[model samples]
Target: MALIFLYIHVLCLWLCSSTYNAQNVFFQPSFLVTRGPSVTALLYGNSSNIILILQTTSPSNVTGSFDPPSCVPEETRWVLTSELIAKTTVQVKLRLNRSLRLCGNNETDTDCCVNPLCVRETLQVSACEGNNSQASLIVQVKVYARLVSGNMVFDNKTIIQNQVYRPLGECPCDLTFKTCDLWCCCDEDCSTEDFQLFKYHCLPGPFGGQFPDPEYQCSVQSSQNSPDWFPFLCVISPPGNNPYLGLFYQGNKIAPKPGMSFGASVSSPPTLLDAYIEGSPILTLKDQYFTIPRTLNGYCVTSAPVAFLKNFDVKCVTPLQACPTEPPLQTIPEDLRAVVKNGVGGNAVVDVTDQLATELNDFITSSESFGSSAVVCENVPLALDYNFYWKENGISGITLTRTLGTVTLNGNVSLTTRYSAKFLSGDITSKPNSGNPGYQVGRPVIGGILNTSIGNDSLLIERSPMHLWKPVNCGLCSHADVRPVLFGENSTSGCLLPVSQLNLTQCGLLRDTVNSLQDGLVEASLVAINGHPNAVTMADWLNISYVTLNSSGVGDSNSSCSNIPAHLQIYVWTLVTGFVDEIPQKDIKAVEISYSLSSWKLECGGGDPVCIDPAETQRLPVTSSVTFIDIPLNTGPPKNRYQINFTEYDCNRNDICWPELAFPFTRFYTGEPYSQALAKGIILVFFFIVASVLGTPWRQIRQIWSTI
Candidate 1:
């Protein structure tokens, strides 16, 4: 067997635990850039008293712009931040209801009635430092149109391979020549320039103009291949481990040593998240440590506005350094903390409870096929089953408390790992089966009775029946497309990819939520797997030495864990209050308390249920929520080092490694016409056969037949 050295970290929750960008934002309703403010709140604009209500208009046709809050009052205020460089141009934040809105009282006056902010001009506004010159505070109301690439969405923060940030060329709205080049929608009057990909970069536009491009670099972490019993690496540490008593793998169910613990929740996660997006952040992300329910000791995490609430608060500090490993953890911005404590205003907990549950069910139910080559448990395919819920924390300090359930570890496991008994030397087989599956290699997984208490939410999954599709008549291809189809030269079908729009992640899984069927996953199928278990064939063909394989295969196994990964990897997502010792290396790390970036809360007149009205009534207080997408990243990027000159991304520089996404979709190859090609082949074969038969003289044939 191959000697393999593993450096896997075992998280102890109590002992351990476990634990971007905006681009083409407008066409995408939930683009990250559109979700949060790029700059921190400039509490004091250049001019404070000269309160100028930026009467900006947000509409569907606007490109490079964020979608405005729905049904909001016609006006919204803008802010300038000290964090940003001096003199930044500001854009309008309001989406205009052209037909319903009345900008002013003059119905007949076109200028007063129509939406004021123009899309053509840059939204960038100069500082309003209450300057003597009116020019300092001058704001432009330009008309713009949408010139978008529905398929070509770009992200500035997340860099992806082959997804280089190409410079976007603007149509150059030539006001001088109303008759310009690119097709576009202009103001009621053709006074502004046409809108094209412009200079609003998430990173410094190395290529010039702003590259509001979006990309993700999915570092293909190690992945087990052709797993025999499904893989599980216990963080013998806290948050990462789920308590399980016995592992039912390949016929053998191995129990953990007495007193030793194992098995984690194959369901809900321990940590939860809540983020506030869509404008300048009222809440800033910071480092924080909170106590776990079981122990007085707590784990520290860099918060996403609210990974921990006041419920877990201890002594607090400021400007958290590094990832939390110290004591007396600091807190996130205080104002944001207050909001979460209050919960009566805009959404406090961006809850994604339902989504996480759905994700959990999907992962738990999903399975991988078994193969003999996979001798080690790490060699098998594994799925993470983590579920969580967010609602009232049961405590008044927090508006909503995120109660996490168990985190499930599931995958397809073989019944009994088989090998050619011929090669089994009495010496190797001399050792007991160890009563463990994949024991020939290192013992990858063990189960034990957990000491912790089990609640109603605890999920105990035993064994699931393994069903492999076989051909009954014509071939397995004749079977329904219900199960994942394999791909190959003889393959009848694989996953079929549907046409899809560009996603915020850019290169990672392109899941189409509205129509789950057409997701990019449907475009490919797991036709074949790579990696070999280094087996040597000897002169005695029957006897082969099974050498262990080193390093994990190249695949998206880690990423598939994300509920997303890469720019923001989800090392561990929990639904319950679990423990984690260390965090993987990534920019944004998060744990949820009572929120999901996807959570929605309606704020009309505070949390007053009475302010709500009938949908039909104008007086019906607007059901409002900052339209947000709970991406793996829920909070805004850190403000400390925003740049004038953007740095190139790892993917752009080809400096990072990426995992291969198991063929998630079906594919079709279009080539030579079958009928015509077959006819040609037949003709060639027919001529050759005829020539051969004729080549033999009749007399020689007769003689040969007689001899026979």
Candidate 2:
């Protein structure tokens, strides 16, 4: 490239002066970026140099005359004309000096500039500098396309475009402007590699920045007002309700598990989590906290705070691609969700998980009461303990959902409590201070609300803080409505939706979804305790009072002014399908399985998550996705097929779903093997028909249906 430049510089300098008979230097038809259909310009130059600027404004053509330097004062007249050949390509023509003939404009043109009489000059277009979209705005005429020319010098072996001619233009709404050029940056592209915002892509433009946020504007254009189209579909929803991103399970807020931690992982050994976290469980809620791991529609928010207050407030992450946002949030793997069952695992974070262990102790004591000798969950803490006595067998599940597409996973974890802590029942007030009853209940904090004012679709989830309880105070939270609004937190007169008690509902749901594995916790803990087989029926279960979204009530100091939106009427129910494995042989662990039907976000990391453009309520009659998740913890993904279903307001579409069954019933020829069999059968039938018509094989007609 450097050598090319050297050659160009030498050739161009030689062409300008070598005693040319025509005394002419004209750039060949060059590719120029013209804002409008036409361009005109004037020229002035001496024998030593020539200054010419091509432009588009009013009159048809631009003509001018300049004298020769170090020679005659009376000069040559040059005409410049321009035309737009393509959207961004242009052709400029220069007509000059017919009288000052280089070789007298005849065959005997020996007085050429460099070597031979024939010279082909060419100029290449470099790049776009700038253009104007508004006529009223007085902006400096900027340089749009640059022109670089090189001569096909007779003796020079290489032709290099070394000379650069850049013309600065003033662009307005159209060609009527005094100087400005009119152009549009509708190329359907912007390099987000540097930043999501592109200056030419209407970012901080002359018009007020139409982009609410870089993630919104730069993402797939989803609104009418949001530039007609964009490079990709975007899913920057408001912070979703807690970790599941406001997704509910089996028609109720999933009871937060006592000590389960959740995160995302894609690598093998599966132990290396992408973004894992655990939080305090509100009171005794079984699965209320963010326990089950599943791919969120957008990006992952830090489990640090569960929800967001407003759009203006800074967010650590968004719902979709977790880019272009402030204070980086953990990048939760969107492909697989990992729930370390024993309790949120001991992976980096400690404060939240420790508190949950205490709360779990409180819950077990309340349930067992210690009156009878059979103490079930009395001494168990979800954390790592030498005497915890937790064991994990092999577990696995396959998710048939939109986001993950289709993922299958299998693993085993074991957690056992080594020590038992004694506690008195009904001593809540004695243990903690007054005014706040369950305030000390290890509860996960939910931040950021979900907004769905725009782009509400069947497969697209638009989460907003507005959906949550709004705070009484904007700046500081004096009172805020936190997630898991418990059974009696909302008054009949104050908040619209009253908290619904789901204690029995929680245990029952678990029983229905997790009992397929004969060796899992449900069996070991009840049906077969300590190698003793005992039939524990549903009748033996106790009616437990688990907190819903109304967790921790509201902070005592902030209780008086709880953010009503965060604390009030927002609700979501989901159907999750996955597998659970419990292996206590070597290590103690709990396996969790879950899956979603539709994408919570428009884009699911891939180019498109849908076969057809998702309609608000329009239903796709027959498109199926088979998701596969590969997880090898040294332990392979379980062979059993499992799934779960949950739903709420699914765009009023038919909530039709296929139940997640627990068997490899489809392990046969349902796929390619079936297709091959089908083809062979068709060929056989065709041959039989031909044979029958031709006069043979009639004996085998009825026998084919029976057997060989």
Candidate 3:
């Protein structure tokens, strides 16, 4: 059992060894520090051993020392087992023993020192073994300083590329070390030359040595291919952190215009004009101050009553001026009144003279009695003047005439006559004459002595005869004829002679001549008559001449005369009297005339024809003793008549004509009396009153009964 145990133990040991050897190994604090400030290192091994070291290309101040001489071994190693696997991670703390300081000169510290020194460092290890081996386990370290001078302290460990670090010691005030001069230091006492060298000379710093100068001159080329210089620079630092900087230069110091910059210079974006970027303000620097140039021009615009530049830079222009207004238009006045003309009594009679004569003539002739009277004659001797007499009858049957003298008449008595007469010549005559018995009486004287004693009174006789006759006379008869006569007598012959006067006695002969003369006189004296009322008045004898001449023929000495007594048996006549006598005469009796009268006719008899009295009946005498009877006529009866004489008549001599006795007829009738008409009206009124009174009460009763 002991021998078997021993062999088993040996096998188990071998297996453990082999398994541990196969496990993976890892390192912590992969970067080793050869600088200030120590870092802890860890080893992750699963049953495997791990070892590490720190290396650097930087030189140490101590010369002739081991490459990574173990002053305090800058790396650590570890091994792990199954029983302790949970605690397999081991920490190798690197407490830097910074008591040792770097000497500026390499001659005094030619041996490797045993103290820690700060330097910029890196940490690395050999390739890891077993399972998945890693060769990139490295760490870099940077160091700050308490004191630094001209010489730079390099790390003993190797560093990787692109690592950044600060120097490990305090910087000297006036030292001019190349790498140290280029390093950035927090201390103000450090020379700025080093910071400036990195700032301006480096690739992308603002003030590197290769950067363009602040005073550098540039030309803005108008090339289509080139991007806009100002806008491109604006995009670079849009907040205007360095607005003065133009494109492709440092410290150009350009600025945007007031009210033009973006964000900073202007709280808002500038108002855009015309194009998106063409009118933007260009930034420039003058005397280290920012300014903007108003360089671009743009389009013009109109704003109604004013024209102004818009979409363009109008830095100092006003925008509210107006154009002039046109003058007020002239107008003409309009006509207002209507046309008018003068009128006759407001009548529009443009010409008045044409109708004056006719109007005057009509006015004069339209009087009530124009040309009415045939003649104007007074009471005069019928022989001295022509008598124009009008019969007292109606207008239809009337005559006119003229007579010659008081004793003998021969004149025209025509239907219309005012006869004109003129005395021409005449012979005188006596009524009778006696002759003598002279010679026979002497012979008988002897025997007659006895008879002479018987008789013989001296006959004393005066025979002076004078004849008077009418020159012209119109016969007062129905025939229209006139005669002019001359009468004479011879005593010895004892014969009466008659002779006709010489005159034209036709109806119109003398009248025509006289009227012609009168018309001529009147016409000739019109102006004088108008001036003087009594100027040469023409006599009305022309009317008489017309009557005589129109009724008689021309008389001559040899013309036969009428066989009538002179101055005692002649009369004037007219034909119209005969014409009237020839008309049929109606003998109207007094009773017939009275009965035919219309005044006695009944006007009303309750709508009936009037009754008439018989022609032969006499009116009854109406006396005080007679009593009137009350007749009860029938309703709607035919008319009746009654006549009674109320006045007395006279049966007188022939010279006194009296009216015949006739009855006075009265039209009378009885109707429904006033009492009856009143009774009927009252009955109608009573019926209406009863209707009004009973109807309302009945309606009320009906309403009351209906409600029950």
Candidate 4:
């Protein structure tokens, strides 16, 4: 009985060992097979260490028989075999027979492939289902045209679909096979040698495939894990909203709905029926429309049409082919030609004439020809300003102003084009008012010669004498321009007067010129508002109230005692009569001019006893500036008043009653007060308790607590 029991135990152990080894032989969780359009393979297996070697065979040489009624050609026969190896993993590869005639030249031939370009064959492995550890698999092989990377080739024959539809569809950009595409690192056919060259050069995928989740791609070891393997473990995850699932399934396809939309909306150019409406395209002389030139994806496009009544300013830098000389119209840009053609006709209301075209051409060629030999004249258009005058009846006229500038050889030019459409009216040429009623800031101040005669009579006409001066040449002074002064603006202007000689006569003339310049500006009156067309009013006119001229001597005969105006400073006052809607209303009230004269002490040069002609020129710096001060207007009388009364204690008798008495805190207290009473009390109590508590012994504190 003991021997039989021992034999039963041994049988059970043997069966358990066999089951463990069988699980290891059939532990294949996944498999991969490479496929193509013409030649494809359909593989099914669950066991590991199984290799497949596929080879093509002719119809006569094939071992299988073809059924004529089914039209199955023997050239589509393929044999799949396995290699006996010691390794645990198996590798499958295809071996092509180049010498075999697999298909006929045309479709009419007997026992020929239906598709000349595409040939398909199937190899059934009936013996693959040997035991429970091995699964039945079918092998299919085919031959067809292969595509190259970056090049597109279209075949009309019916071929097997080689599309790989993942979350992202098949790489439309990766059209090549067995080669590495530039900036395409995700290509599977690329070897290690190809990847080493373009790994870092991979461009961002169109669907953001280049930037994938790092956790999925990175190989994380068990030792490198943090306190929590996933930091967002507690976070609420979103549902999978995959878009490709709607089109593809597990090895199957689902056609998308025809009504589904994708990408941006397409906008069509406006036609003649939509003329004068909002967003209507600009019209041209022909049936076409005006389009703006643009560049997109390294290609030039002229389809970006412009809209009527839409003002825009665009600037672009482009290369220019330059030379010393060219034809008048050759150098002209296409934009200029479009402007000239569209200057009339269509919506244009102006009367067309032959002279108009002539005038336009003449204006374009008005500049000198680029014919200079000393300087290479690479003239390019700088700016194009288009002003379209429009009314209710469409555009009345169009004016184009083109600015051109020369550039260096092999250089780029920047062109700015501006288009503006303005409404036309009878009063369009009239000047805009400075303000509604009161004088506005930055507006030109009204200034002119004032007549002081009581009766209407002509006075002695005086020379419109030069007053202010500005620098013309190096350190040389010239008469300043008569520019209108603006309100609320402080300005400074000056010049240098160079004197070649410093004799008594020249000194006298210099003194006279300086005095005359200062005197003329001193008497001028400036009005705060614009001039009236009728009678004159002097109520708001500003006159000089104070004048100061600083100098040591005034005798011009003494050459040594020379005094000339060096700097003049003007101060103007304005009255602000309150604000209307937060804007201040101001008017000029008064003007004051002050001058500083610098005297030159002449010394004899080169041991000369008396003053002689100096070889060096002398320069006197003259400067002038204006400053404005605003004073508020007094609208009413004083609001408060005080009357003096006598008291019993006078300031002389009682020191406390003094007008300039010292502050109470300064006289009564000599140092800082106890302002922080709460903080001081807390500090004092804390220190007292610490001293008392620390003085007591531990045994005494225990006894006290027991007594309590």
Best by TM-score: 4
Per-candidate Cα RMSD to the true structure, in Å, reads 41.8, 35.7, 68.5, 24.6
TM-scores, all models, native as reference: 0.14, 0.13, 0.16, 0.32
- Model 3 Cα lDDT, one tens digit per residue, 1-708: 999999999999999778657645555554454444565556666524434333333334678332332212233221211223256665554444443332444536533232223445544434334322443245455544333342445432222222122222222222333334333343343445335434433333332223322321222323454455643442332222232334222223244344554554537765332111222221111212111112224322221110111122222111111211211111111110111111111111111111111111111111233444333222211211111111111011111122211111112111111112111111112211111111111111000001223235532122111111211122111111212111111111011121112212222332333233222211110111011112123220011111121223233112221211111111111111112234421110110000000011112245332223222221111000101122232355553442123222323334442342211111221345555655666788799999987797888988999999
Off by over 4 Å in 1: 1-135, 141-143, 148-708
Backbone clashes counted, model 4: 3
Estimate, for each residue in 510-608, the C-alpha lDDT of model 4 and write its tens digit.
Answer: 667767665655445444332221124545444455565555456655544456776677776777765779787766566667776677544556865
- Ranking by TM-score, best first? 4, 3, 1, 2
Give all candidates' CA lDDT scores: 0.25, 0.25, 0.27, 0.46
Q: What is the Cα-based lDDT of residue 577 in candidate 1?
A: 21
The superposed Cα distance between candidate 3 and the true structure at residue 667, in angstroms, equals 99
For candidate 2, write residues 1-708 as lDDT tens digits: 999999999998787656343433332322233332123322111212332342222212445321111211222233444554544333444443222212222344433322212222221211111231110101112121211112213233222221222111111121221111112122222122212223354323322212233344344354665654444554455422213222211122234445655876446655522222222221112333422211234433333221111011111211221112221111123321333223223311111112223122211112222333431222222221111111132111112111111111112112211211111212222211111211111221111112335454422111111111222222122222323222112211111211112211233332222122111111111110111111222222112121232222233231021212221121211111232342221110211222111111122235442323332211111111111122324543543432113333222344542331311223334545755666776788799888786664555665685686
Q: Please estimate how well model 4 matches the true structure, expressed as its whole-model Cα lDDT.
A: 0.46
* Residue range 1-708, candidate 1, lDDT tens digits: 223322232222222221102211111111212222222223222332332223343334647443333222223334432332334322323333222222333346442224322223223222222432222122233433332212224332222212122312222222222232233232122223223323232123322212222211111222444233223421223321112111101122244455644876366654424332222122322322211211124432333222322222322112311222232121122321332321223333322211112122311232443442322211111111111122243112222122222222233422211111011112221211211111111211111122225465553222111111232322222221233221111112222222111232222333223123212112211100111111121110111111222222233231121221111111112111222343221211121111111211223455554234322111101011111112254344553442324434223444642321211111111245556555666788799888877775865898899998
Error of 1 at 387 (Å): 16
TM-score for candidate 1, please give it. 0.14
Candidate 2 off by > 4 Å: 1-21, 27-50, 54-524, 527-708
Which structure is stronger by lDDT: 1 or 3?
Answer: 3
Q: What is the lDDT for 578 in model 3?
A: 16
